[model samples]
Target: MILDALFFLIQAGLTLFFWAILIAAILSLLTGFGILDTRNRFVWALSDFFYRVTEPAMRPVRNRLPNFGNVDLSPLVVMLLVQACMLLVGAIRGYMIRGGLYF
Candidate 1:
């Protein structure tokens, strides 16, 4: 019972975090090309928020990846990593829920 509840919480938390990272990625793409002007206060604030939220996850990846001049691929890498982590957690929970090794 407790394990079930814990699994649910983990699933939900990972899902929400995945979405947050996705949104930040989209906002970054748009802002990078100036499709969304940051001159306005609201836009600036929103962009800043996304930056603050995603920068930590992205910076390390960015540093490790080979630079492509103007292109940024850290967001894509981070998104893939987040998805992999979510899948790994879900699979582990599923295995435990089904009594894997005990069987």
Candidate 2:
């Protein structure tokens, strides 16, 4: 019972994390390449919000990574981490089920 609830919470968090990383990466690519202009107020606001929200996770990675020409790899790293977390949660759930620890 408790394990099922915990698994649900973890799954939800990981799903959101994956989506946030994906959106941030797409936004970063569009903005970086000028495909997405922040000229419009709505675009600017959305970009700003995403930047603020994702930067804390990305900045450290950005600092540590070497630039690959015009490409930014921090968001890729973030996405990978999110996927890894989801996989980890899945593995935990599997283990619990196999052991009959989750009801």
Candidate 3:
């Protein structure tokens, strides 16, 4: 029972993390394209927060990747990695359930 609950909690966390990364990626693109202006303080703060949170993981990837004539692909790569992590977490949860490792 306890193990099952723990697995559920982890899955929930991973889902939230995945969604956050997706949102951050979208926001970054919108800001870059000037489609989503941060005139409001709230928008500014949200964009700033997301950039800070995701930049560390993205910086290394950006440095290694070649820019395609003003197009930045770092956010896409980061989103892919985030999705991969979510898939891995789901697979582990499924394996635990199928193997009867959790009660």
Candidate 4:
């Protein structure tokens, strides 16, 4: 029971982080293209929130990846990595269920 609950929580967190990274990427693009004005308090706040939430996860990926000029691929890499982790957790949970190992 405890293991199942732990897995659920992990999956939920990964999913939330995945969406956050996606949103942050979109917001960044909009701001870069001038479609969204950072001068607007709401826009700025939202952007800042996403940046704070996503930056820690993205920083390592960013550091390892070679820069592509203005294009940032760290979010894409982070999303993929997070999805991979979610898959791994799900697989482990499924295995535990099938093997009756969740005691």
lDDT of 3 at 53: 77
Q: Model 4: per-residue lDDT, tens digit, 12-64?
A: 99899999999999999999999999999999999999999999999999999
lDDT of 1 by residue, 1-103 (tens): 6667777788787677777778887887888888999898998898898788778888999999998998888878887888898899888876875875322
Error of 2 at 47 (Å): 0.9
What RMSD does each model have against the real structure? 2.5, 1.7, 2.3, 1.2
The residue-level lDDT of candidate 1 at 53 comes to 79
TM-score sort, best first: 4, 1, 2, 3
Which regions of candidate 1 fall more than 4 Å away from where they truly are? 100-103
Report lDDT per candidate.
0.82, 0.84, 0.79, 0.94
RMSD (CA, Å), candidate 4 to true, equals 1.2
Residue 36, model 4: Cα distance from true site in angstroms: 0.7
Give lDDT tens digits, candidate 2, residues 1-103: 7877888998997787678777877877888888888898988888888788888888999999997987888888888887888898899889988998878
For lDDT, candidate 1 versus 2, the one ahead is 2
TM-score of each: 0.84, 0.83, 0.73, 0.93
- Between candidates 2 and 3, the one scoring higher on lDDT is 2
Structural RMSD, model 3: 2.3
Could you arrange the candidates by lDDT from highest to lowest?
A: 4, 2, 1, 3
